[model samples]
Target: MGFREGNLGALGHGIRHRTTITTCLLMAVFFVCYTNREFLRFPVEHELSTALDDHPPNTLKLSDVQGVSTVSGDHPANSLTLSDAQCTALFPHAFDEIELALSRGPVKRSLDKITNGHVRARIYNGALYLTDRGLDVWHRQSAILHQIHRAIVTAPSPSELPNINFEFSVNDHPSGDVWSLARSDADKQVHNTWLMPDFGFWSWPEPHIGSLDEVHDRIIKTEGSMTWEEKESKAVWRGTVKWNKGLRGKLLDVAWDRPWSDVQRLNWSSNALAMEDFCRYKYLIYTEGVTYSGRLRYFQMCRSIIITPELKWHQTTSPLIRSAGPDQNIVIVKDDWSDLAETIEYLEANPEHAERVANNTVRTFRDWYLRPAVETCYWRKLFRAWAHVTPPVGQLYPEERGTRWESFILMHRLHWGKNA
Candidate 1:
């Protein structure tokens, strides 16, 4: 009996000793990780290590922009010094859409279809001037103007910009050498319409969706607050059924009463989900509105799998989506959505693959392409590329252009009255 007690005591002592050693080792590991936290962070690819490498070596300082010296440090003009290479690195297919728009040839100004509703503008001596005030629809025209101003004011060589004229349309559909929000594949060849960044990049106050920068910060916080495992394991969507009854309506029918679906008709007056809240679901459904839905970019910011039909309308960053292969960041089902249920089931069964797709979405959109710096870089590139297609006609007259952007914003009481 005494021998048995002695053996048990020794065993207890050994366990205590091993436990102590294990605890110490774990503490040491935690200490090392905590001390080297910065090194352990996610490697940010957008770091400005070699920013502006492709820019002219003698790039002018930001102070060269008129009235920029008085701007606050947080102003966009005070930051975002990206170069062509840096922008291309962040968004590999950045110039694809631009090249497509200008592919036909030098823009024939006579072929341009301008109406009283379209704004006639020009860049003269690196300054934006508006000769005609197009009726602002949902503040789109004004928002576009602000974006142009931002691109010019924040550029490295604002003074050296080419003198070019452009007509901007606030309509959902436009043709000719006019700049617009989006263009369909069918009309892309039929018209010389150029796609600009959505007006929401500046702000969409009526819907209370705020600016792109604000949405960026909000989505980052929301996405980081939850884990993929904790998110609802269902495909989620919310949109008005009336917008595109064929597409959006079909989605509702497919998702109706399905245990794995959380689709609902949007009640904009009450139950509309905040853009950031959509991150709580495992999958997000994207659909095009009249043209391209601006919400796609916001959804791309989330760490959730994007499930959609083959997209008809292409946005500035739409080409980056890889629907197949190892790099597939989005799940593209048929237009009729007949396979949506099976796709959702497959994703639910394969959690790891779904998470990979979600991670890729965040990496492609939030971390790199849709970033503020990339957007500004795209706008500047647009200016340079547009100047190439829009050659000066007969004479170069800078004085004939209408009101300077600074004065136009102040004088325009309808849409830009807030700036005034």
Candidate 2:
């Protein structure tokens, strides 16, 4: 009886041990599967076709919907389908206004010889419009127009549309995951705000100094103290300034003078000098002897110094300036203050170079860094930052699924407007 009881007790203990081992093995398998599932999922590709496929069927397509033909393809799960009329309504009117503005410039020149003041501009949507102005209009207007035109030209046409069916799994913890679709680099830059030409310069507040005398007073008040070495060190610390060779001596002599000739004599073309002045005197109430204030001022001064009427003459006459760039938008580098002074003085002395630089300078801000590009980049950066902080949450868990699509759409619209 004792032996039988001992055998039964040992059998029961063995059974309990086996059960515990099996439970642990099952738990390990489940953990491995869950971890692999999180990592093995496909990443979101930001291409147009991929975006259309991955997003919900009701995702908004911001394109001109006119003259589109849709045919059925191998239908995948969650494919987007819309009637011809439904697609047409997606085109934004703001896009049309922009395209009309850009077309006006080319149309005006073509119509200049004709009686019709109407300039026929071809839009990206294959639509045409008439405008009275040229491309040289206000920067803000021109920028908006350019963006609209770019979007129209670049966005894929209806015939080129791809299949919009895809599969998505519900995540147990959807809030921790993020998914977004963006255009290709080229397309993104074309449509996004960061690449807009006038990004940093537009809406720049005007400088605080009203006149050159105020600038001089500010400089003297700021740098009036210290030893000769300190002054030189301060000047060096200031970064770069465009002054004539041996002008340091001249500057020292006139440091206390209310209207220092050095201000007028200071070379504006030297980016180094301009940068130095900005760095040194940025916080000073007076002119730390910097030409303009801020980075925009530095850029403008560089442009002015490089493309002045005198510099243009050098391009035509002297071989030096002509050797700089293929597109004449080249920046010339100088070795020292003397070199800068000589370049500026030489250009000023030469009539041909002077005229070229003058013409080029006038055209630079108008043609290149206009307002539209600036506003776009500004808005885009803002949007991207916002998106990063508060990522979009899609329908996944029961809680998210319960929310209405309209609520999501409304939230996105509100975000865009607020950021704008």
Candidate 3:
């Protein structure tokens, strides 16, 4: 009896050991498969690193005798540094050619004159301005402005221009325009508006659009369409204006003209909202008799839809505030005002669908609209603009370094969050 009991005990122990071993093996296999899958999925070229560096065969050395002038001792100040000269030589005739080409077009119209027009121009520091009135007539309304700018900056002369020709067809009207011409047109517009300097097109240009009021009033209207709808249940209405200007306009045009999936459309909409809330909603519904500031008012005007999530609306001084609740309700009550009554009433009446809608809206803002990715992109763009205005190396300015450090911090924070 004792021997049989011992055998049974040993057999149970063996069974437990086998089970533990099998589990561990399975887990190991899973981990390997998961890791390998990602490794294999990445593009091979992207994963590879070349051993050889293909820098320019020769670098130019700057000396006192090389027509280089120094402001203090051997260092230059305001004068073009070696790096600046190198950059200029890399893209010789870019600025002059752009200016000349843009001049060939009709005089650009002023901000006050055009009802609906777009000035897709770049600005530099505070010089070399370009405006719609400054450019010639034919190139003023050209859609290939960006292309033209790129051509003239990268390859100013016709001989320097790329051999490849870009053609665009609008209702069977195919225009065989040279890339350089398009870039020239774009550069001209950018220069005229003083936007080229800010964007590294020309040198530093002054800020053209000053106050938001001027921006709002002077924005060139496009021949686009807008759709409006009122929510039957809530005191809110939604509107969306489809314009033929800006990046969103270009994207929408491409999507509609080409074969795009519903997922793509949704992605585009979400991305558009991520960039600017103006594209998602046009109006902000508020309680009547409440006076709003210009900035807040402008936000409402640009928004496509407005809804009052709060119960009571009162006038106060504060910007729009996003509320955090289980329903993801957004309360835009004036500062120091309570709209609890109206909000409660709406929630109670639409209990069935209110929570779901609010949750969905909140998710959109949290995941896409206000995510780190979008903010990072904005900061990157801002940094690029700053870099464009910075003086060349050896003639470095204090502000440039400060801006660079600030940008670096912003970028780091964006990537790793505050904890990082």
Candidate 4:
């Protein structure tokens, strides 16, 4: 109902776009051995639970309806502008019963479309039963959910059927026939954060992005109060060194644990510290790990001026820092992370200017990046476009052959229950 009219291409926030870099994306296609469905459910660490428990006071709250109501999938809807949409004001406690049905593929449907990870699908009973080679948890949890949540929130009614329950992997990256489909399809950037916007943060714990507002608030309370001169002079970088093969190690070398630089090997994999713990510096540097770093979103929420190398990957937060723009929200460096020390000194020398840019960084985050409103708009647009192309759902696992669905049910019974 609140749909706004705008151009899709206008979605670019104007950060300087970079050409795709050669990375793991080019490596050999890895296939995941068939595993039990229980693998999809990851244990929620206590620290992660605590960190997310910190929610902002001002988050949007849906009122009026006592509980979720069923909505009709066949209900007609109009296109909306990206700016006019908002995050689902309310979501039901549970998602609809659906499965992402993937079909085997070797046929190249389109030559031009980025089909590396393309998964084809058709709309059936309000669900996008997808056919792909494989599924990855990182993409599904981070990038893919962005679309599903929008549909859940904006459905004609709560009762409207949900779509596409996934048999995604627990591994950091997934392989197999589904890789190409999961990565990209003819037009579905559905799972790529750079191409398709997401929360730009992790939604791993049940109740997506549960602790983000808290992270933002803590950063403000602890770091925002400090004057530029009062804070640590050097830029800070803290995270695990396991996944970020080249960049993470290269970064630590640059900092060399100098008197001013607070860089350390904090194993965020175990759990993240409180916001105050990370927000003590005037400058912060972000480096990618595995695929994309969710920590970048955490860094942006801080009062510190963010510095990092050119981003090889992107998420919902890409456009703001994408291309070097007039307002210095982020100081992007080379992949080698060259001149980090020099850059730190330049910002420290101009305390007033640095602080001003830091303020702009906050505004950029609050006003646009990952805000419920911006996310909502993009979500609506994705479904709106897909409606025109939805195909009829065909049975992915026929009775004559093996059915992964049975394995899914067994896994649910053996491991994860309704609570998970």
Candidate 5:
């Protein structure tokens, strides 16, 4: 009996020992997993790295994995940084205006067509030369020149630029392949005028509106601070009525004393709301002044539903507006603004839809299309496209034609021409 009891006790002890060993093994595994929790949670990252190792270096660009198309929200991701190629790829419709202008066929307007209020320039041997500044009064030519320089310097292959001569007008009216800030579709059919990105892309010297980037940053911060629900439930507009009395006057009549109206005639002499503050309202009313309003892009920077008439004029960025259905970013009213009240009522009733429209605006303009990277890409593409359509510039005498752009900008007194 004593021997049998001893055997059972030894067996019981062995079972306890094995149980402890099993517990210890489990504890060791748990400890290892706990220590490397983050790594274990994202094992795909390691797998991806391992897979990447098998490929040659430079096989994948940063853009390949982190392109804007991967982004999925209404608000822009803070970490998103698009490469030039990515920017170009993301906004495929950006250069539509340029394409339309070139569609009329290769540029046939001679340099002589550039008269007063215009500038003639050439890109030759990877350098910019300013041949003439045709009585430019507003210093818009300077801004345009600087933007071109900015685009060229930041370009991937600045040293390999094509030799092309072009002319641009800073004035309101431009025709016959002379690059201008904005042109109507009607004007496009009548005139083979090319359109460049507006001067406001660089800066707007008005006290109310400063540089485009600076204003955009301020708007981003302002919009970020407030929730969608916190914004004023009104359509806001402030601009001079005289610029386009037919449209602006009609808007004033429609919005006058309306519960949803925040329209006011802007008084430049007195205090006016800063451009960034315009985002405080839920809706923004866009109106063209004489031609396309330079303020349109700034309004787009806000995360508000843009309300505008059927835009008759085409700016470089006009093609981006989606006016109907789910993707509609801007709200288009009748030219007379007769439907303005009904539209506002619809938006007031359908808050989710309105918010979606606003979000779409931010996603389209501020986040993707109108971004600085996209603008730079557009400039480079413009250069290439223009070069493709224009004749090669003949021999250019730097001294006789004009000054090198580098020297021209640095001069205290900008000489207009050979006479100046």
Candidate 6:
């Protein structure tokens, strides 16, 4: 019994020693692991922080227009710069359809038809008139589409048709997911807006489509007849205020009643003032309302210098101003419009420079947008590229079963242009 007790006691002591040694080794391993982790953290953190600081998102070179980086209400890094010069059309055969359309003479007829659940421009004796949709909304799309339709009617075109079946895009951005508009039952009975490759929406057929003051300088320039010397020196702006909630209102608040500029809310009903009258002034304030302004094109027609903030949403008109840059064709300010008052003051003080800038602006617009062949050329490129990329189903506006828009193209094509 005594030997057994001694042996048990010895075994207990041996077990205790083994446990202590194992515990010590485990503690040493844990201490080493903890120390190693603590040692690695500082360098890893520094390297990660350095990487983030060194290369932030959307970092761009000064001249790089490869990508657009925009913050809401703030001008992006490369917003107004132009991409490298290249041919406007993606493919060579882009204008064949347009050429064919232009060659077919006197496709003209007059119609007094009301669009079914649609609003469209009607041609009468080569004049354009808008069908009353009775939308009564003072938004950008309605106003711009109205103006472009008017331009289509009044502006000279390659095809001098008094009547034709027209299909085109809405000039303004429709309010909602743009892609969804295509997926669902298209409002085909209504004028549909389609996306062009670069920017802006395009529509078809009635289009003839800019700026210069001198009889020598003018080609299709219908407005802004006065020379820069004869014009009012103050900067002038007229537009509706409902959609341009923040930045535009700030413009009015700063410039209204100031001696150097004239700013007023546009009265929609009155066509009393002609576009030329507005252009007769030396400076025009160009700002975006809902998306982009079709008004910029009209301003281009006059001799006045266009002054605008750094552009956010470029309508189809942006590429025309690419070669012109900020200083030449149009004066660019900060998106916050920090420079509006100052720019007006400077232009008012330096009349000759302003005149020179105005002339250059008109000259740039003339070369870019107002040439005799541009109307046909633009359509040709647009149509050709569209054929190349757009699928067969897309050729006809997307249709829903039993919807009016689905039957719209066929119905119009068959029946329209019957009357003279």
Candidate with top lDDT is 5
After TM-score superposition, the amount by which residue 139's alpha carbon in candidate 5 deviates from its true location, in angstroms, is 2.5
Count clashing residue pairs in model 6.
5
Sort the predicted structures by TM-score, highest score first.
5, 1, 4, 6, 2, 3
Poorest 10 consecutive residues by lDDT, candidate 1: 49-58
Error of 4 at 384 (Å): 2.1
Error of 2 at 40 (Å): 30
lDDT for position 41 in model 3: 31
> Which lDDT tens digits does candidate 3 get at residues 1-420?
999999999999999999999999999988987656444333421212110022211121223223333444431211222222222232222234323424444332223432222322222221111232222332223323332333233321223221211112111111111111122122222222111211112111122323332333322121023322221222221122232123223333332432211112223334322212332332234332111111232232232323442322111111113355453334453322234335435554665444454334433332222222222222222223223333322332333222222243235221244555
Model 1 lDDT vs. the true structure? Answer: 0.74
Full candidate order by lDDT, most accurate first: 5, 1, 6, 4, 3, 2
Per-residue lDDT tens digits for candidate 2, residues 1-420, read: 999999999999999999999999999988987566433222311233344455432242323122333444321211123321222132122122223223332111122331211112222112212222222223333333343333333333422222111111111111111111111123222122111222123322233332222333343344345222222211122213342233333333333233211233333355324232432321111122221122332322222333111221100012212324332432353222333344434654664554454334323322222213322322222222222333243324333232222342234221234455
User: Superposing every Cα of model 6 onto the true structure, what RMSD results?
Assistant: 22.0
lDDT of each: 0.74, 0.29, 0.29, 0.46, 0.75, 0.47
Compare candidates 3 and 6 on lDDT and give the better one: 6
Q: Tens-digit lDDT track for model 6 on 103-138?
A: 432322223453222244333333333433323322
Off-target runs (Cα >4 Å) in candidate 4 are 1-147, 155-202, 205-210, 267-272, 322-325, 388-420
Model 5 agreement with the true structure over 97-173: per-residue lDDT tens digits? 87787677787757454477788887777677887667754468888888888877766567666677888888876
TM-score per model over all chains: 0.77, 0.26, 0.20, 0.54, 0.77, 0.46
Residue 280 of model 2 has an lDDT of 36
How much lDDT does candidate 3 score?
0.29
TM-score of 3: 0.20
In model 5, what lDDT does residue 347 have? Answer: 92
Choose the strongest candidate by TM-score: 5
C-alpha-based local distance difference test score of model 5: 0.75
C-alpha lDDT of residue 207 in model 5 = 54
